[model samples]
Target: MNILTFDVEDWFHLLDHKSTKSEKVWLNYESRIHSNMERIYKILDNTNQKATFFCLGWVAKTYPEIIRKIIDKGHEIGSHSHLHQLVYEQTPEIFKKDLECSIKTIEDICGQKVIYYRAPGFSITKKNIWAFEIMHELGIKIDCSIFPSKRSHGGFPSFKNQEPVIVSYNGITLKELPINYYTILNKPIIYSGGGYFRLFPYYLINKWSKNSKYVMTYFHPRDFDKNQPIISDLSLARKFKSYVGLSGAATKLETWLNNDQFLDVSTADQKINWNEVPVVKL
Candidate 1:
């Protein structure tokens, strides 16, 4: 199965950056989420595809109509956390508060229970496995926060499986759908989302998709917005990673939409045989 997802945040929601971290500073930047998301909506509409949008609570609060529009079009809505903070950087108490705030905000706008989550930057690494317990308490049924391979910001290198698995914490169980990866020289490499989706050639992606039994592809609004203003103060490497393949991203996505069948994460979760999936004890 192919699961299509989008991390719904504005252009300025750069991960791990001190300058753009604050809510006040976010207010200073021009909001491009609406227009950029419209571009995404057009693409999905033309292709008759439905996706899961993991929206930041801040975005929902700022643009409630956008959340309504996404739901109106029959797409799933999932939480991307409030304020876009990394889970590893937060205490359990702080994380719970932020999660509750995000769920409440999204639920208030859409009038539906928020049951799916994807951490900002995939930040629920080994250091924060406790996050699963908290999410279970919050009634989340599935989590897509564990990036199975090492990442610069937050990744779970100790995680053994890339496929969907059931995680048991206390008495609650939550399904973890780690980001997809492919083996290279016997080592797993991620090409399913973000900069990797932009950086890798389409042929390699096609090969990986054909080989994998289940693939979850993720993208952000910034990926398709090549005209976005470059952040001048970012490190050279960061600048390149963020902006290198912008021009071709939209075309690549359109190609995939035309060729493949995709379902939103929640629907995919429902279709899976959870009893047959491996269980991980936390």
Candidate 2:
């Protein structure tokens, strides 16, 4: 009835507007990352559930074995861009290059075509919507790039507040599986589905999902790492948003999996396809 996803990158891959930050530091955590991968591998293996991993191309290129491990375990592989650059910040030319680089790297490592992509920070907004056409040009069929709600990172402040909707982009009809949101009494409420998902009370997440029709959830590998290095100059809000709900992420995930019926994003989309023509009789 829902989809569970993972954005597979370490905590340090985050770009903040602090002093200065660079993703080059992501390459420094080889052993820890691999260990985290193995931990996720074990958890998914035991739970008998598969999740879509929107992996960083940098991670795929640097650790091909980890990418292979994901495929070998029967999980879906999708791109999260080559450098983790925010999509809205780049020119269309640059965005195309970044997306292609990630796609090619992922295909090379997994030996399968990569079809799904989740833009960094969900930065695919109105200003940069042409990027979706470019994605179709490059052969991507599914995009999980629109947050459909506001967040501190980069989100459309006025996209649909509930449910994933299909949007036409650049003469193409690729599925847009926007991230999940919960609205209480017709007002929007943000909960643990990404960073917030891990930070808040797990019971609330369960309750929210139980009351909703479509629940799209995501977490990052970095979330499971309680010992991650803290950002020194992060603003109070950024720091709070990033660190508030981490320690219980893994446990909360296990609980959600045990309770919910989930499919990877692609599979869920296929199911939606088979079930509807999206027309109403007048």
Candidate 3:
């Protein structure tokens, strides 16, 4: 099944290397999350599609009504961490604390247990595989954090498979739905989300989606906002990755949604047979 998800963070929640401002300075920026999310809500409402939103705890805390609105509209809620810290950048203790904070914040706002998670920038790499164990301990049953291919922030380059699998650590097991990628010239390239989704043509993305058995497509609020102020301090490469195809993203997403069916992570999980899936022991 195809899964539609959104990482609910603001324009200022840029990756570390791409951002010049610190968390303490984030309050200075005008928040656009509500309006941008409203745009997304309208699209999903028009299309009659439901998605899972992996929200930052900060966003949840800052905009509790938005969190309630998501649930009110029948969308699933998942945690995207308290802050947008990369998984590998945090120690186990810090990660657990952040996870707990995010879970509590979301649960407090929505009154539903959050069992799905997606790391910021898909940053759960081999170095921090232990984070999964912590997640299991904390009651997260599914993770969409493993970018099977290499990424600038963090990725599981050693994870050769791009499909969903069960990962067992110690005595704990959780389902992993790694971001989708396609091979070109023997190099795995991810076009399902973020900058890649903006950078690639719609036709090519459709082709890749058609070829894959399942696609986990993701979007962010910033992707559809054309008026967001540019981060001038970012390098040219980062600039291109962050802002390229901004004007066309919403159109592309609409076209894709019109042609395909998507399920939330939790619903998609229910449709699969976990026992039959391959297991990766960490």
lDDT of 3: 0.89
List model 1 lDDT by residue over 1-282, tens digit each: 889999999888888467556898888888888889999999999889999999999999999998999999999899999989988999999999999999999999999999999999899887788898899999898898888888878988788888899988777789988888999898987887788999999888888988999898889998999999888878888888788899999888888888888889878988999999999886
TM-score of 2: 0.92
- CA lDDT, every prediction? 0.89, 0.77, 0.89
Q: Each model's TM-score, in the order given?
A: 0.97, 0.92, 0.97
User: Model 3, range 1-282, lDDT digits (tens) per residue?
Assistant: 789999999998988553422567677789999899998998898788999999999889988998999999999999999988888878999999999999999999999998999999888988899999999988999999988887788888898766779998888899999887888898887898899999999999999998989798889999999999988888798899999999999988988888888888878988988888889887
Q: Report backbone clashes per prediction.
A: 0, 4, 0
Winner by lDDT between candidate 3 and candidate 2: 3
**Tens digits of lDDT, candidate 2, 1-282:** 688788887667766843224655555544467877777777787678889999988889888888998888889899988888887888989999999999999999899999998988788776788887888999988788877677666777577634555667545666677676677787677664666786668788899889887777777787777777787678787787778766777877888788888889878877775234232111
- Candidate 3 similarity to native, TM-score: 0.97
Where model 3 places Cα greater than 4 Å from the true spot, the runs are: 17-21
